[model samples]
Target chain A: MQPLVLYVLDLAADGAFERCVRRVEARDAVLSVTDLSATRGDGVFETVVVIDGTPQALEEHLDRFARSAALLDLPEPRRDLWRHAVLTAAADLGALRPRAAIKFVLSRGDEAGDGAGTGWALGFAPSAPPAAPPAPIDVVLLDRGYRHDVAQTSPWLLQGAKTLSYAVNMAALREARRRGAQDVVFVSSDGFVLEGPTSTLIARIDGAYVTPPTDLGILPGTTQADVFAGLRAWGEQVATRRLSVPDLLGADAVWLCSSTRGAAAVRSIDGTPFTVDDALTARLRDHLDARKK
Target chain B: MQPLVLYVLDLAADGAFERCVRRVEARDAVLSVTDLSATRGDGVFETVVVIDGTPQALEEHLDRFARSAALLDLPEPRRDLWRHAVLTAAADLGALRPRAAIKFVLSRGDEAGDGAGTGWALGFAPSAPPAAPPAPIDVVLLDRGYRHDVAQTSPWLLQGAKTLSYAVNMAALREARRRGAQDVVFVSSDGFVLEGPTSTLIARIDGAYVTPPTDLGILPGTTQADVFAGLRAWGEQVATRRLSVPDLLGADAVWLCSSTRGAAAVRSIDGTPFTVDDALTARLRDHLDARKK
Candidate 1:
């Protein structure tokens, strides 16, 4: 399998993308060493699925990307330029791009001096989705160490913003993997169920599908949003609330939703099993598939 | 006046330093776009000072760097190789290398398929420090949103590890700046004094120098450790305690200490002023200077 195919956005001659897409070599100079992304973990990024040669929910991803950049006080991302880069990347992958992930990154440039930021669009097909029925994911509950209201009360926490500082998120996932779990759903220190390291927590409880509110400092789940809309259109009740670990355990069905992975049903958490609701899972999976643009 | 001088450590060909140092251009690929540090912020780093063309406390910094890598479950860094790179970088800086900061970075390589990691040593002199009398800084007290014991109780928190996921720290500094303060002292959610965004906090109280312990998830300050040893040898008492916000505001003096910036006295926190203890600050500053090698 080839490594990441990075397409540099040529912002020369007064910052214009005269050349739209070029393959970035491994040793090529694509980023300044002083980029805050490298130095301070200061950057924002998004990974979207390229479905059948079309980027899925690219505008939403860009919207969220811009929001993240804004939170970091970075200049507004040139959305049209991003759209072009994403489209070129998706198109370059040709017919095999279905289910490929297109990563968009914006870095805080060279902070130690030498002025100019960096942006890139990378396209790569993810390894074939885990053995059909998407294999129910075993998860661990980890503390996020922030209160549910921290995003609202403490703006500096950068809650709800998808910044590049995902070390904690990655650490939590590694911890889960170490404990023989495939995933993790972070619980607030105060005990409210939050979201997954790279996904959003959603579950079927009391005839309604529920997701934790993003006010808890979790990134708003784009796939979850699309799923809720699809479910609502199907005459089903979809809601948001403060959830608990026990609530997840007692739910009829639970799933972690994300842009790339889509609907991954949670079978167990902290090694505790819950009977899988195959019908509910299939319904949500179908709805999620139907929602993809 | 110049950009970051990134000395790449080529680990291919049996982990040998094939190409010792190369001038990494602005657009050069010092890192894979897919490097987890760029993608998921999965990495650890250290910034040590170079005095008279020699990196000070290189061994201590390497020890902490190794500790951080362990906390991240990363492969132990090749310290001898890192030392080679650091020396080459400092020597490359030539006669004016005094007080330059040498940053060492280790990233969890490409997350896609490539398994090799990336390492670099960057040397650059920092901007000139502020004028003498040192214009005591105004600081803001921000909540870090975790109990001080989170490190002890939660192994996955990666507490006290100096990982590159510093977005929160950078944001806190920006928040402080926006609030008309020059720096920040992060307070634990449970009302205990933690540390600063980029430095450790210390205060002069009851004729003893005190700093919040690292068990509180604060990065163990190498400079603080050096200062404590120096002070103890000078017959001054140094202690560790769970301090409160009021402890800082009421102290004879407070300082934010780090390797590069040394010790910067706090004049005010959240608009509350503290009388500067110049005599005490000078004593500690002199001790810190003597300890620097």
Candidate 2:
């Protein structure tokens, strides 16, 4: 497989998209540069879709990013500056490709570049192009073995931060890879099904679209939120609640949605294969497409 | 306050000290470069003391680093190479200053990094001296919020590895800072006092030295091990068992030992202040100095 071209950006560049590797100093001590992972993992970010020179669900993505930031106890995002940065990056990659994937990493910055403060870092990368939209993803359940209060707002140092403390997430992915699958679903020790590595799970059960409640501490995915809201305008009943792994496995249909992939249906659950229902997937894609325009 | 000079070196050089801040692109994907905090934090490292142009306890520190790596299921360290690197860095710095600090970081490489599938980074740095060792750290009781299996070694990693997953340690430091102190002693939720942020607690009670056994999953500090062994040679009955925070607070003298500062007596508990006897402290210091030589 060929390596994909990713567009990397810094959060400080105002309305400018440049292609280069630069290290932004964290506002803590010189120690901050060496110990980025030691600080609280408390910022929020988004992985977005760029297709046909258009960024899918830009507004919804930013909205959730803001929410994640708030949850992690970060300061209000400068939207005008953020919007310009995203758009500029998209525009710069315009002539090169019709479709690409972009990752927006927002980390907390130290209020000042001392060495003991906090700040956020925003990163953009172009990697794998969006998979065939509406393709179902394989779902595997793994016990994450820990629980956190998803209710109380995370400390500004912790809540919605896209921290570099991603060891557990990487462990799950490694487990999934070992199982001959591309992605895995995190199940709480108590059996609640949460989200994916970089995707959100949306289930169609009893003829309604249901997802795990955002208050459960799952990242509010920009792409999933847009798809859910768009489906609701067509009078589709969308509900948010706690879901167990068994609940997901027994669902009528399950789809993993994200800003880049848009939506991928669950092809199997714990090795049990499921038939992909084309009609429901087509409708969801159509609704998302309409919203994108 | 004086600016501190640290020596930086590569683990690959096997202790051949290169100039400080020298960058080497040895691995295609520097586990140090990739974001893999999501796997396991199972690596071991050491912070060494350099005084009068000599690395204090160089041999014993390497022995502990190697032992820690083995205990955490890491490859056997290249001791000759690693030591040479430290000595080289020491020699370079010896020319610039009479006293310095060097830290040895040994992590699992990404492919070999931690038992997980990411790379690891190992190196040394010159560090600043501590603030007169902490007049003995003011101890605090904390709950062991996570279930760590210290007894059985699963492929699962434990607290022994010096991986970048040091958020909890820093948080403990922050908590200590909140209480107007410089350090903290970790008490398991079950009431067992484990260790400190970057030091190990050794209590001198009834003329015997006691530290928690590594069977509890604490990183065996190179400096702590040497102190204990030294005390035992002088006929001090050093024992390792489950000791509570209260047990620590009420000891004759409680000391926090590390590679950097040999020993700092704990001067207070939660609210009770303890007296530090200079003769006892001097004896321990003399023992440590003789062992290093």
Alpha-carbon local distance difference test for all models: 0.79, 0.57
DockQ of each: 0.61, 0.18
lDDT of 2 by residue, B214-233 (tens): 76657777778877777778
What would the per-residue lDDT of candidate 1 be over residues B33-106, giving only the tens digit for each residue? 76777777788999887776777778888999999999998888888888888887777665655557788888
Index of the highest-DockQ prediction: 1
Highest TM-score scorer: 1
Every candidate's TM-score, chain A alone: 0.91, 0.76
TM-score of 2: 0.73
**lDDT value for model 2:** 0.57
